[model samples]
Target: MSDQDSSSSSSSQTEEELDGEMDEETNGEVEKEESHRDSPAQSLSTFSSSLRAVIRIKQKYQVMKQRRQEMALALSGAGTFPGAPTRTSPKIFTFDGVTPSAFPMLSSSNPQKKKRRRRKRVLFPNRGTCRSPPKQERSRAKYCLYLLFAIVFVQVYNAIENLDDHVLRYDLEGLEKTLRREVFGQQGAVEGLLVHLKDYLSTYVHNKPLVVSLHGPSGVGKSHLGRLLAGHFRSVVGETLVLQYYVLHHCPQEADALQCAGDLSAIISEMVERAEEEEKIPLFIFDEAEHMQDEILDALWTLVASKQSNEYLNAIYLFLSNMGHAHITKHMLHNSSSTSMASGRHSALVKELTPVLRSSLEKLHQLWSEANILPLGLLEKGHVMECFLDEMTREGFYPDHSNIERLAGEIEYYPAVGGHEYSQTGCKQVVAKVNLL
Candidate 1:
């Protein structure tokens, strides 16, 4: 009975020892799981710190990039001309929000020369490696960049255009010297036109825009004079500002006539606005003004009456037509004095006869109907026979009469005494007729 008791006690003791070992094994397993769980948290913390560092770097990079762009704009403006790039003083970077502990500070122990060389190599004073911006920050930064680029481009273009304008301003010294040499026997008329034109273009003449109506028989230098004026003005003002539209060519079909008129209105509006901005005079020439549709004329009447935008104040309008030619000739025929007829100086006669022609143009309501005229008059007379003959010869037309007498005789002016037809057609058929003659 005592040995049975001892065996039972020994078994109980062994059972307790086994349970303690099992408990230790379970505790070890729990500790291992806790350590594994803690590792994820530590790794997350590390990742967060790395993200903050990258954000800081990006911020610094953005600041540096903006500063560099500003510097580049300034440098480009200064170096707009070729052959030399502008040199500006180097700018130093400011470390405002950055912490020295976060990023190691780089120190330069090199000489001034070495430092200058390094500075030249660097795009920015504070260049550093950094990751791309975050998505939200990236979008904001792109918008700012685009805005900055647009503003810079506009400013640069304005500056360049201002410089270009200064270069483009020309001197019309010799051009102003010999103005009326193109046409013959119309020196008086041409001189009169030029005087008024120059006066109208005069800077002090701020009264209103000039409106010149050129009237004559067909083949007169009316259209040719218009071309000459275009060339002269193109030399003075740019070719862009001198707009010549022919009613016969542009306003052909009756269907789209109104549309063409509206298009012209829009164009005139834009050109007037442009002229006002540039402080320059714009010229609009309507060749064959008598032939345009009434609707188109109404569109132009706005410019004529100065009834459109205030910007129209800086523009000039020229109307070339044969509307008042018959009235001019009748007045001349009735009033040609015996002294004038005997002197036979055509220039003097045309010059003296201008007053009656002006009166006749006033009666013709078709021209400058309600508009205020500024030194306005009709520029008339065909090319002089002498000038016509020279031009014909220059054009490789050798008439049978080498003396230029036959060509001169053929160039007949309007209101020829009884039954002669000479230059009444102006410069129109002289060449073709030269072959026929």
Candidate 2:
């Protein structure tokens, strides 16, 4: 029985040893599992950090690309094309928004860098912002307004340059009243004279000069009417018509009629020659032609005949004389029946005159045939008033009808010879005097 008890005790001790070994193995396995789980957490944290760095690098690269494109566009003189890349880099910032930290790697340690940076800041203060206005549109609007003002100033200067000082201005009403009495009242008498003058001018007279003699008493305004006709002719034609003034006063010193004819012929030839070369037709006005030497009349007759071929020399000789027509015609008949007889009497009388004078009178009859004669009569009361008013107005003075009546009364009844003494101011003064009376 003691041997059986010893075997049982040994088996119990073996069972206790096996239980301790199993517990040690279990504890080691639990510790290894805890270590494996902790290692995974650390590795995950490292991976996350690396991924964030990569993303930041990519974002920085994109911003740099945009900045480069914007700089190229601003500095280049070339205009941008369609579909060009327009993106600009965003400006990088430090912790404080006031300071920029972009491209800090490019900064230098040299003192010159600070100066360059300062200049850059001055040139482009908002360089970081880089937002711009459209440039081309603003410049075009400024140019258009400048052009408009220049055109208006030129037109005003041209208008002031064309005003004339010599032009005479008159009311149309006053002129019509004068025409009614002088031109219309004479019935066909004035019309007949104008018709005859027109016919003589148009007709080709062979060596025969047209002598239109206007004979009337003094203060009749005959010379004034002649000037008016000459003015009308000039207006119709583009150029002025030349009218030569000749005054024939009775020369008490002249020996005979022929000598006077020679002198007159030389004067007519010189005037006619000048008119032909200048392409002008002249009117010879012989004022007081009746008082001329008989020789002078014959010399004029010769000149009219010699100028037949010269178209420009085909002239109108207006003889304003106080001599009656009957006396003139009777004198012509007594000379001779011969065609040269009219000029011969003057030639015979002036044979002893200068050689130049003798040669001039040789063709006196021909010149006489080319002349036309027209008689001027006294102006009617209305016509006289109209002329006086016209003269006053043209001198920058205005006159009423009462002024005209007074001027007409002062001059019309007075025995003043010719209208030369009828001064425009004198007419006005006379009206003022009458007003006082």
Estimated TM-score for each candidate = 0.51, 0.37
The superposed Cα distance between candidate 1 and the true structure at residue 379, in angstroms, equals 13
TM-score, cand. 1 vs. native: 0.51
Q: Give residue 340's lDDT in candidate 2 (0 to 100).
A: 38
Cα lDDT tens digits for candidate 2, 1-437: 33334333433444355445545544554445445445656676555655665565556546654554454445332333456643322335445323334435544454468887887788657655768764654677567777766666666555433221101112122333443343411322244445555454443332444556554445444555466555554553223344545444434445655665666565566666665665444566666664566567656655554544574345667766554433323332343344433233333322222232223323433433343333333334454566566666655566777866776776533233222222222222333444443
What are the Cα lDDT values of the candidates?
0.61, 0.47
Candidate 2 residues lying further than 4 Å off, grouped into runs, are 1-190, 200-207, 230-243, 248-263, 274-280, 305-313, 325-373, 411-437
Instruction: Give the Cα error of residue 273 in candidate 1, in Å.
Output: 2.1
Q: Top lDDT: which candidate number?
A: 1
Instruction: Give me the overall lDDT of model 1.
Output: 0.61
* Candidate 1 ranges beyond 4 A from true positions: 1-179, 307-310, 340-367, 370-384, 396-403, 410-422, 433-437
Q: Estimate the overall C-alpha local distance difference test score of candidate 2.
A: 0.47
